[model samples]
Target: MAVPVVTGRHARLVRVTHALTTLCFLALVITGAEIIISHPRFYWGEVGNVNTPSLFDIPIPASRPWVNTGYGFVMPDQNGWSRSLHFQMAWLLVFTAFIYGTWGLRTGHFQRIASYYNTAQRRTYLLVIFALMPFMIWTGLAMSPAIVGTFPFLVTLLGGHQSARTLHFFTTLALLLFIAGHVVMVIRTGFRSNVRAITVGGDTQA
Candidate 1:
């Protein structure tokens, strides 16, 4: 006799994972906005200065009175707190994504993947959105010259840092759109069933 699986916990995890992803996305948007505004002209490879000046041309005199001279906002320096927050949140996102993806795979989420490929799934849009994320993460990490510089081809693949930055922006937009759609769907398609599936790890009446 086979043992019965406790799906409630899984359902809860799913719900939590979605909530977390949504939160992380907002954080990413804010941090990314800071970076872009500060350094509109992005560089690729080791060609240009990555540590450009920030948009806030004002000085925080109150924060650091000990400094002798006035200072203009610098991208690398100004975003220390923002960058740290972004990195910390990104780590959470990456870790949570792994958990969610693993759960999906183990629980025959691949069936959904397959259905999308075969054009049998109801919401094929989700399949496309799902496919984009890993690629975004891969390119995002690859373009980071400071971290994981193992692959030389990455430079060419991304057409240097500038191109990577562009792609990252587009990907971010895509993620935002996906989130918007996801929220709309969750609300439109009877939130109760989704809530139950997510909270209790059990299928509801379809």
Candidate 2:
């Protein structure tokens, strides 16, 4: 049987959404790493007393002489602009995810992506998406004292900010893994075909 192809306006929209999301994720990864390492300490294990630099080597912005980023019980100082950037990136991510998720549901992106897969494949796809993505965003937010403080119940649910930080790290790791798997799947599904679909509406224009 001939293989099905992605074509037309919908495919173009999907491609654009994918591109934007990819960029957002990459930016967040870099900024998030810098934010996490600003203190040179971690909630999990001994991150050690090492001085870790920002991921992009970009200097933290100048912001009010740098205050301590209050992570519940732990407060780290001289984080420079890492805090601001982190919060900015967090907002951007949340917005991007909201738009992408809404579009996905409205456009049937999820269904179309999984329609070709078997039950097992579909399960993995949904799990990575529904379970992992939401968890990452949630845990990331929970790390903020302001957020946790506002919703005291979050501290209980997350077992404190320290625990939230730990969960955030793992969630980021999971996102990375999901991105890798997604890229691989895209390639396997026919890179050229997919690219065309995304760029020019399937291969119709090709």
* Most accurate candidate by TM-score: 2
lDDT (10s digit) by residue, model 1, range 1-206: 12234432334656788779768878878887665555454444434442443222223332222322254433343456767777788898889889977777677654544553335334445453376676677667766776546776765676766567666777877777776776676678667886677665566433
**Whole-model lDDT values for every prediction:** 0.61, 0.62
Model 2 steric clash pairs: 197-202
TM-score, one value per model: 0.65, 0.67
Model 1 lDDT-worst window of ten:
60-69
Deviation of model 2 at 198, angstroms: 3.3
Q: Candidate 1 — which residues are off by over 4 angstroms?
A: 1-10, 41-78, 112-130, 191-206
User: By lDDT, who's the top model here?
Assistant: 2
Model 1 TM-score, all chains together = 0.65
Candidate 2 RMSD to the real structure: 8.3
